[model samples]
Target: MKMLEGKVALVTGGGQGVGQGIALALAAEGAHVAVAGRTLATLEQTCGQITQRGGRALAVTCDVMDAGDIERCVSEVVDTLGGLNILVNNAQIVPLGRILDVTDEEFGKGLDSGPVATLRLMRACYPHLKGDGAVINLASSAAVRWDASGYGHYAATKEAIRALSRGAACEWGPDGIRVNVIAPHALSPGLRGWMEACPEEAAAFVRSIPLGRVGDCEDDIGRTVAFLVSDHARYLTGATIPLDGGQAYWG
Candidate 1:
């Protein structure tokens, strides 16, 4: 049988990039997925792809910064998909700049899009999540490795998510709800833009990895998320799994 057969999943930022990949992956695993994001077009595209592949999916318009949107999103997913079995918190506004160059507004933007939204989503989904339900929060290698050039705010929020996931794991484990973080080095739209602007640096970064390659959004990161939400990972919780192709390690 398919690993996630009969499961219902919700993926934030599911309009594009890693979130889109994850939504499609979950659907491929026999789960009906709700692709939530602010953009209706992109969400529809993701859902369309899933439906074309004979998987069930729904496009939910949601702005993570809005509390009402978050609440409504969880409700819509449950209403449309029957029940919420998995939640993937994969949306974030990535701010790139040296620490000294970042302003309060810029830092706040990162927090609002990342940890704050993650926390709100978790709380919104808490009551709906039954025993064996799973949550996969996205983290980053920047947080684990601390590059120190750019990604200061991004790293901070990601680490915050890791901490929050650990807390949730402890608090919700007995209830059969598993919470974990995935630090991915997948090729995202932001990463693609960076590579185009600084091809040499991007190449060097790839070379530095022991695996000699970065990760693919759908194939690498998405599959890891699928595993995490499956019964195969039933014993796992509060762990940070690095999906960076040997670029970084986390204990």
Candidate 2:
């Protein structure tokens, strides 16, 4: 049987990048997907791809920083898909700046959009997520290491996500809800420019990985997330899975 057959999943930031990859992977496994993001065009594109492949999907435009938007996104998913079994909190905006370089506004925006938004979504989906539900928060390698020049704000927010995931798992486990975090180093549209702009740094980064390569967003991180949300990982909760090709260990 298909791993996610008859399940319904909501993927935040599903319009593009790693979130899009995860959404497609879940859909391919037979789950109905709700692709949520701030951009309708990108969400539509993702939904179109899933539908073209004979998967059920819906495009939902949502601003993660806004609680109202999150509520609407969850309501739409439950109403349209019947009920939500999985939620991938993958919406995040990384503002590149050092501690001193980043203003209060930028730091606030990063935290509000990343960890805070994830918490709001978890609360909104709590009641409906009873019995074998899964919540996967998208964290980053930066959460576990230093970015040096920039990314203090982004890293801080991701670290908060890790904490939130662990706490939520402990509290919700009794309700049959599993919470976990995924730290992925994958090639996506968002990271492509950085990789190209600093080829040596990027290449050196990839060489540190035991896998001898950077990850492909869809096949690598996406597949890992699908597994985590599937019955195969029913015993897993509050774990941080580093899908970074072992770069975290060496670096």
Candidate 3:
């Protein structure tokens, strides 16, 4: 039997990148997935891919910054898939700017999009999550160490997510719910943009990693997420698993 057979998974930011990868991976494991994102077209694309592969999935339009959107998304997941057993908070926005260049508005946007949205989604899914349910928060290697100059805001938000995941695990473990964070260093489509935006710095950043190769989206980070939400990680909780291919270790 598949690892997540008959389970229902709700993944935010499932329209693309790591979120899309995670949604597809979960569906491959026999779980019904709700692909939630602000873009209906992108969400539909992800949903279509799942269904075409003989998996069940639904596209849900959600803006993580909005509480109502999150609540509605969770409700739809339960209503459509029967129950919620896995919740992956993967939606985030990265605004590149130096610390002095970052405005209060931009800082607020980053915070709201990252850790704040993660906390809101967790709270929305808490009541529907059954015993043994899993919550996986998508974090980043930026939280583990400082690399670039303009990513302090982004790193701070991810760090908050890591701490939040640990706190939630400790509080919710008694209820048989596992909460964990995955700090990925994968080559998603966004990687090109990030690299191109700062080529010299990006190259320098890659040189710091021992693996010498950036990770692939689905095979690297997605697999880690899949495993964390499966029975294979039943004994794991409150842990931050680094999928950076030794980047964090070398740093």
Which should have the higher lDDT, number 1 or number 3?
Answer: 1
TM-score of each: 0.96, 0.96, 0.93
Count of residue pairs whose backbone atoms collide, per candidate: 0, 0, 0
Per-residue lDDT tens digits for candidate 2, residues 154-195, read: 878898999999999999999999999998888888678888
Candidate 2 residue 163 Cα shift, in angstroms, is 0.8
Every candidate's CA RMSD: 1.2, 1.5, 1.9
What C-alpha lDDT, on a 0 to 100 scale, does residue 135 get in candidate 3? 99
C-alpha lDDT of all candidate models, in order: 0.89, 0.90, 0.87
Q: Per-residue alpha-carbon lDDT of model 3 for 3-118, expressed as tens digits?
A: 99999999988988888888989998898999899999999999999999999999999999888888888888888878899999999877567889988888888888899999
Q: Single out the weakest 10-residue window by summed lDDT for candidate 1.
A: 143-152
lDDT, residue 171, candidate 1: 96
- What candidate 3 gets wrong by more than 4 Å, as runs, is 146-148, 194-205
lDDT of 1 by residue, 93-129 (tens): 8877888988889889889989999999999999878
**Which regions in candidate 2 have their CA more than 4 angstroms from the true location?**
146-149
